[model samples]
Target: MRNVDIVQLSVFVLFLAAVTVVGFLAARWRRGQTLMHLDEWGLGGRGFGTFVTWFLLGGDLYTAYTFIAVPAAVFAGGAMGFWAVPYGAIAYPLVFLIGPRLWSVSHRHGYVTTADFVHGRFGSRALGLAVALTGILAMMPYIALQLVGVQAVLTVMGITGTGPAADLPLFLAFALLAAYTYTSGLRAPALISFVKDTLLYLVVIVAIVYIPARLGGWGNVFDSAEAALSKPDPATGRPSGSLVTNEMTHWAYGTLALGSSLALFIYPHTVTGALAAGRRDVVRRNAAMLPAYSVVLGLLALLGYMALADPGVVAAVREAGNPQLAVPFLFDAAFPAWFAGVAFAAIGVGALVPAAIMSIAASNLFTRNVYTAFLRPDATPEEETRVAQLVSLLVKAGALVFVFAFGRSLAINMQLLGGIWVVQTFPALALGVFTRWFHRWALLAGWAAGMVYGTWTAYLSSSPAQEHFASPLAEIPFLERNGYVALTAFVLNMLVVVALTVAFRAFGVPDGADETSPADYTADAADRLAAPEDPGRALTGEGPR
Candidate 1:
């Protein structure tokens, strides 16, 4: 057993309790007629302005796993881990272009989930179901990684116990998360994000500035990290990593950044955040402004190097045999007890915000696409909202299961695996936003091929620590150079989609009816008055007017 820090635990608990109260109060913050509708519960009544949308999307995308895992990756792998910084930078431009279009269409048509948009656009429930299931599958590990973030902080605070009881603190924290998420729906996270983001920014800014000062400045920190990383690893008989990427590793680094950027906004949670905006301009403005978080991400990644500069932190991490502890341990050792407690609370609350949003997003997909479409086509809006609320709880429970089952391995890899599955939906959801020229059946077939190839390639990837799902990089077929497996699989997915589209057209196969029009993609909130409730009318050439 480890000695728990009483002052730190008390401060952490106080901040957590404060947020728990705020979360429950959010249900009445902006009251709708009732919380019995998906518009209010699943999408926060679709009325968030620029201020709220910025925080919500920032809190959602820059998650606790980001706080813990990115730094941990930097601590373990050196320069390659900085891929997260560039990928984050690249994602926002893509979001700026795609976000407004998706928000406009989703706003006009009352789409609560990406799957709903897919079903309407392609006029193929089968394709919609594929997207829905893939989203749910991808989210499991991602949500679990958030809990792993909390666990790492707890472990650093010496709150751990033996065996099954060790996880009690994690479950208890998530239980609080589930309660408010069920009660307030999207509003819980939207309101709580203010607190989460504020604390996170305060903690990160202080840590970056103060820690570097304490460690003899940034230059010394980098020199120490470089010396540490340049040492040969006994397991691989190679240098752990370097301060810069060389030719041999450049392709892997570039592809990882590019593939991650493509996958970022395609996540159901990000889509949920974008669609919740009050206007199309909210999405665009937030996308243009959200790069501010990327600066914080770069600062956070530098903490890994700072930790390497501190011999105490390095020794503690070596003893724990877990790199995820680097950031938490760094803060704990480098700061006073009260400030360290505040930092811990920041990470913990950071987990709650995104975990709540992700579960809500996943539940929205299930309730709209899976439950209503297949289980109860005639289900009322009230029934749909109720089902979504319950599934949100189940999604949290499933993530808990994932945490226990997977143990506390590398949290970043788990997120990358989720990204691999989520990116497959891009052709259908992201591409479909601008065009329906590709046959719906071909999109379905391509999704299947990408899923199979990505999963198999990830399975074959082995590292010194694990056998399967060991790394996100695999050798690109024919290229013989290692790169992100997701991108390779995505290329295969697109090729299949293109080839099948041509053949199906040549054979005169019937393309599914398109339910969306060009105007729909560009429509603003002002156009909502004329938007169609019945998308099927477009199938009969009676388009929404």
Candidate 2:
């Protein structure tokens, strides 16, 4: 490892302190609001306008993981890594369809989490519990991946060390994160996202345009990457990378892109940002505008190929035994110390935005679905907000444990595993918004089957480099060819759901009560759904009376 660059470290520290201040002050951004309620604390007063919502959702969705891992994947897997570009491109269209409906129903019903929607929509606490558990489980590794991004920056900056002492800086950073998130809640991330996005946009644009010029232009960069990737790996006896998906990878790439697009908005963090909007139109507007990030993402993926063109970077990261550090190392080697620090800050701040949002999303799930629904049915809004605040800190602790235990070596695999677990909820949560024809029991059973199959198959997949959680791709059962494990499991899940729904109907098994009206699914911000109805004084994005 090289000696720490003081210039880069100083710029990074300055950015970190600035965002921390922003986070704490965010609680007062909209003054006179009592943040004692879940609506205020967990969803940022549900009053972010179009401009803020765009930044918030973009920061939340694109994430530090996208900034770090997509490039790392390209560095490691070649053309297959570019699946993120298409997946990101297709995601907003899917969000455009589902976002308004979810916002409408969630607004009309005062639902804070998807489990709250499921519980109220189907009147089945058991099914809501299932969804809640699935969300919390999936979010743990996803949050850990964000920490991995931060850790990569630190590692490249020469701040990371071994043992408990090595993690002190990370621990201190998250402590600050937990404190501001506890004080300001969703508003912390919302307010800080502006700064994060600014730094990230500047860094990514420079890396794409300026770096290629420094490295002998785009043509040379691509040629170098292709030459490197075409060489066969000594361990696996397969080509290291490719410019396009071949017979072996086509199925996995296509399925991963499609399935990830379907699952994107269904994750609790994604919905948390959507529902935080002040108006239904905000969600739709953001959906149309969010594709701009995908353009940046496509540009960002090329940095991986840029790294491959640098033999010094490839050798250093390979010596360090982590592929996820590729982008950070690339920036460190190619840029001056001061500019490199700015790039590191971009990634570090990028991780903070989504990490805060995800912790809130998971905590909201626990507070609404588990704590109140099971332990304290008479819990007040103030109590719910308090529990969520406490749980947010706990969620961060869990993510820290996961990162420390698993280490950075498996960051990408763990994220893929998280996706596999999360997508199983699609048949229950996402489909439930459009139709109530699915029996709650059938959906639950299908979720169970998919979770089991996905997990077991993922466990069985081992490569020459690793013994478990080797890759997201696996052979399709009975087809004897490789595909994304999550998508393959989801197909089995839907088939089981269909078969069980038919049998349950024939047996006259009761479908749970649905409290939502058809109009509720399409209600807009202008509708009377915003009027005071429930005694809890639900948020209408106008602040408390």
Candidate 3:
């Protein structure tokens, strides 16, 4: 706390203020007929073009947590941390395949949330409600993880302490976030994302290029990391770092990558970004182009090695007792104060973009799925938008409470658990976009089974540092090998869905009607945007307003 640089703090504060102004002013960008409709407030009038979608989705996917935590994972566990690279690569291909279909169907039907699509596709409000609840629950921990990223930067900048003081800056940041997101909805994050992504590219490029030159070289950095990681830790009695995975961890790495990839776009925030695009092609083009961030992520992972090579970063991280601070501390130590502040501001804005989107996504889920589906079936557009705004603020406040109560490590744990829970929604949401053969009841049953199993399994798992929900990986069922618990649960979910679909069909149990047509899945941007809206109502029968 004593080493705070006044110049750096000023720079950081300056950039933050600039972004806050951007957020508040975004409400007027592409101003709609009014901001009362879910289409306007929740999904930015569903009008963002290719370039905007590119930056927005990039900012949403490559979060501050990705910047801070991937390197931190590498710092602590070596080769395992680099699973993010493969995960990012795996994800974009899936995104290219699924994203446009989701956007088209959603745009055609005026679907503001994934659950809205599920409900319409399955003709079952209960299934939609289930998906909505799962999304909100999964998103909270994810939002909390972003706040943890912000807190890490604040901690490194000597702005953190105990009690009320420790959380004051975090609360202030989130308060400002909630304010603009409430006023502008998805528009706020969408506009600020350009700034966030630009700064991120600058900071990441500079850090990767300059820091290694200052340290020694990439060769020495890797050598130092490998050497440091090879030493046995007294707590686990295992070596941490390697250039590649060994026999014991291969399954874990592969499954983690695969599972995380499957879970990535299914998240509400991710889907929100995609669905907010003006055109279906925007989704596809961005999917192809967004892999540029994967390249950045791969380079970013090497920061762990650079941090390992720097004795100052290593010692500081040890004293802080939080590996999440590794990147922030590294930046502070290695860069000039002004440059370091720029980097810190990049990380802070990184957190803000996703946090705003996640809260908005969760709010959409609540307003459409819970409030409209159950509580106020005839709520007007203005009421729906108002409710969503309030919930968005509440969601952000909940995430703040989550970080304060559980601390950073548990926030990480909860995010892993959230990933496990979110992947369960795939069979219902993603598959439904391609096929309606899945029985609605069967899908519901599978979701329930997966949620219960995944949560219980994750809760039982423990790591050296924590007692519950410590890791996303668990022993493969009856295989005596470790793999991502989420993937395992996903398989179980699919099996149950298949078996039940068969049994239900055999018994002649009625499958619900699907409201969507085949051509609806292929709806183009011109058709969707040209469709007329009925004020205070959704596009189709009893859908979300």
Candidate 4:
């Protein structure tokens, strides 16, 4: 940007260079006998211990989205935006109960993706394919949210205007993201996470301390937010929009949080981060420790009130021309110049770490589940790796399309829609891990029902602020508008499965054979002796049994 303070720009550049090095060098950190295998290139050889997974999962979940958007929500809405705080709080407990089971089973079977577990457990290629497709599709918009996160920061840092320079800055960002992720695989993002998270913690902690003190105190912060929420809607004279008080908001917000946490671990990208761990315990420890990020989330949401209390932040954000820049503008104007530089880097680097992980996760699904199963069943590991790399590029391109396609509000909704779609995979993929008694055809029927119903319900929801479908629910005559779209779709999915299951059983439709047994789903350690996938074999997908 034309007005960027030279000192802050230098600090920000230093941070960017550091992240680039971490990404490029991550390839060498965990050496596999073969680099081409899905297990190596896609997963970092499945050798990361608790410390690495701690960073990896932390990197995946908290993300640039949490850093930028959550605060932006606070800036726009009020207390209701803080729902993400409770969601993270509720997520770990769910992960604790379910993650170990998935790990135990996947390790036993050498499963590379959640879809792989579905394939072997239910013996249904179609159901496995649905899981893969949902994951890839959901990831497209979710990954784009990270770019949105970067763009929000860039907007504040003077990147966007009515000219070529605005586009140049973003294109440069894309080049850097593509370069690092391509070189490091999962390792690059995981390694970069340490610095990114540290910077985020520093920036948010400083803002929390400085902003509240400058405004007054927590009491004033709450009072200011309540005052804002109490204002009559310009459209409706009533308390317009949401005010996060009492059990109504509580249940809606709480369920949204829990359901999201349940869905989070099952998301292919999140699971991909976990599966790279050296042991199941690492997964467990990270599940517990990662919630520490939630505390920061709570503070970030509170910054909305900080912005509300300060006219300067409001004026600065308005000047920048986007609500997403509220937090960044507050930082630059409120804090000293050097600290603002570091905070900006926090958001920028934060984007790269999650971007890299998402690209890798999407790539793994393509190489292992799609190409191997349908296109070329005889493909080797090397082929799988090559194809995975190609697909990773395409995935990023699709995500870029999404990033450009929507406004911030729509982007948030699309990201939630992505989550809703991904959550539908839970029945076939997550539940299948515990048992295989459900017929494969039943699972497919359930998946189809869930997809159709979830999409339709989302489409039905529309607001003046949003097109297509908005706000997750509408106050309809017959239906309650309070709960999650995913929860409703999941209920419908299960109903279809039960109905079809009984029919399939009475009719004696044979459940195709599962190669894996219950005991096989419980192993956590990798097979050190087995040969890793070669480049040709890896990307094209087919591999040795």
Candidate 5:
């Protein structure tokens, strides 16, 4: 067995225990009449203001995998990893535009998931089911990667054992996550996010400042990193990575940034965070404030270069044969045991916050769009909430199973795969908020085309370490340049949508009814109050208000 640092482990456990208590207590943080309604349970009563929404959205988007993987990407591939920084910068402006609209519509109509909006907007259950399934499917790998993030931190702490015992800690941690998430719903993550983001900010600030001063200076760190990155890998004769993008890589980098930005808020977890806001202005305000995280993300990405600067960290990561270990190993080598323990706790709690939100989001999709729409059209608010809580546990458990069954590569591949699938929903969800000119069938067809092309293209991609699902970039057909598969597929999706809509309109195909009003997209909290008392009737197009 590997020797564990007792001080590091102790600090980690103490923080984790504290957060567990906070999570359970969060059930009463903003107590409602009862947690038996989707409005209250899944969306925290839609009462979160700017401060809580900022932390919740921050905790939701800047995940633990992000904490580990972004730097690891830089550690493995140099400048390309910094694409996340620009991607993050670009995403929130889009959020500033899209978020208030989504919140407005969801709040007005009692929509819990993006699929709920799609269903009401298009008046097509089939299209709604398509969106729901895609969200759940895309989220599985994402949730699993959070577990992978926790496991990476644990592995660096020397918490290892044989067989099933190796994953006991992971299982226990997730069990704690599942319990609070089940009991407190979205409120659990929202409350704990205050702690999660605080620790993360503390860790990043200290690492960026203290680590550089310790390693000679920023100049020495960059010089060492440039030297290390320029060296050729033994597995391939080509240079491992470069500090700047070259002619051949510019297209890939730009397209990656664009695709990732477009896909960021489309993820169900992000939508969940946005809809939890008390007012549309809360979503808008949080969007403007959230860009502050991009600055931190850029600084965090520098840790990759910092790790490369430190021979001890590089050697430790090399010995482990996993690039994901780069940041953790850097912390272990650079900080004293006790501080390193704090950093580990930051990563662990970071995983829990996002993981909790992801499972809740997925459950909301299943319960709102799938279970209620198909299984039991007459399900009460209480039954829907119960089903969502149960499904949240199952989602987390499924992610745990996924981590052990698929091994480590799935974590590496998750961002691109999830982006590829989730971005396909943009037309029905994002664009639907603006216009409904696109035929429902056309949108569904476009989604199908994108899903197939993206999945197949991603499957054909290969890398030195793996045979399939190995890269996010592929050769664009007409452009004849390497770019993000998600963007290329998204282009194809749009084309199909346009062509099919024109063709269907030319043929006079019947377009589905739209239940939402133009005013719904611009409605505020006061407008929601003035609207119908029973918004569920609006969803089902039942009795008159």
Candidate 6:
């Protein structure tokens, strides 16, 4: 492919600068006299209403990972990639049923992190700490996958498209993102998402409609793909892993979409996005509306299939020699160079929006759980904000290691593996939301069993083509009869919790104090303004806001 033009590069840079400005200005947009408080920093002053919550949750859930990886999967495989669309569509109803209650419980009890809620609900600090660590662990790699999304765009526009300085451009983007996020907290990402998602929708729509016409029609485009993929492997005289026959990868990707969507809200960042809403109704409305983004996701994933349909597009992307760059190359070859630049920028911005939010979410967990729990027991609101700011940078730095260490292909796989690891926390975070009677000790063992089982199952699987564990996205590890491991692990987690609860009752194992009641979980509208720490903490030595 030709080198990116100065005009195209300038357009990309211009949009990034616009986003940074938006992020910085958002500090004042949602004006709070004191940005010193954890409430203000971590949750965006908890004042975003229906309209902003639409953008905020839209930004948080449907990230660059959705834009880049989903397309790449569709491009690499086939219809299984479309699983993301249905998963997201179904997630809305799931959230609608559960989200309001989660918001109510979090608000009334002053829980900033899911760990805080678990600890309060079950009266088990060790269990809460485990949940918090799992959240941080799962989120960091997921964030790195977003950074890799930026790299995928850069590889097409710079490193592979141009030459050298490929690394520099992404570094520059991250430096600016980290600066703004550190300065503005969750507000930076929430504010920037409006621009990021708009550009993405526009670019995806144009690519889907325009590319079909340019190639053949939609029918011809798919027909060409079927022919291309059906061809002999040339050397091997066998098709290169037929989508229909590759049951392992297909089941894996499909199940991953289903399981990951379930795990999505369990992530602390997702909860942060939900709780940042000014009203519980805002969350309810967004849950119903957010699936609209899946239309764009389906189109983007189809871009991958479109790439496979046309060999000219494929050969051009091969110059860059990375699968994830397939989307940018397809756009560059099929569309005008200027639009390609805009699409690239859209993906780059898409990456930054979620990366910033994820870093904030993980850092918020660290500050609220670890620092406040064991370190500065008497830290003020201002000090808590400072701690979160520092931890946010460190979380990014940790994710940055994964981004460079594995680059795109492995980073994506790591994100899938990370999902399995993180999904292990779902039993504690999700089930505990509805009940406080699971017995804290049982929940702890369930979490431990899940973490062990999910990791071991993922580790045991490998692909001859990829020469690695192919991840949960590619290989759905099942039992003797076959079933999803993440889902399986979750059942085991629940079974352990239930069995232990029964046994503990027989033996009279003391269930810890239940801090949250049913009424507490179903908080009223007036409960939204409660502080992020429990007032009961003042009675204990847990300090005050």
Candidate 5: which pairs clash?
Answer: none
For model 3, give the 10-residue run with minimal summed lDDT.
Answer: 530-539
TM-score of each: 0.97, 0.96, 0.97, 0.92, 0.97, 0.92
> Candidate 5, which segments miss by more than 4 Å at Cα?
405-412, 529-535, 543-545
Clashes of each: 0, 0, 0, 26, 0, 1
lDDT of 1 by residue, 198-309 (tens): 9989998899789999999989999999999988887888998888988888999999999999999999999999998999989989989999999999989988899889
Off by over 4 Å in 1: 529-545
lDDT of 2 at 311: 90
- Residue 463's lDDT within candidate 3 is 69
Q: lDDT per model, in order?
A: 0.88, 0.85, 0.86, 0.75, 0.88, 0.75
The TM-score, computed over Cα atoms with residue i paired to residue i, of candidate 6 is: 0.92
True lDDT of residue 352, candidate 3: 90
Ranking the candidates on lDDT from highest down gives 1, 5, 3, 2, 6, 4
Worst lDDT run of 10 residues, candidate 1, spans: 532-541
Give the Cα error of residue 445 in candidate 4, in Å. Answer: 1.7
lDDT of 3 by residue, 1-545 (tens): 65667877898899989999999999999988898788888888888899999988887888876788888888988888888889988988999999999888888777888998899889898899999999998888888888888888878888867788887877887887888999998899999998998898898889988999998988988888888889887687878668678998899899999999999999999999999898888998999999888889999888888888898998998888788988988999999999999999998999899999999999999998899878888888888899999999889888877676564753446577788999999998888889988899999999999999998998898767777677888899888889988999999999999999999999999988787888888898765532345422442344343
- Give lDDT tens digits, candidate 5, residues 356-400: 999999999999888988888878888999999999988888887
Model 4 agreement with the true structure over 173-262: per-residue lDDT tens digits? 677877867766787887888898788888887887787887788788777767766777554566533446564565556556665766
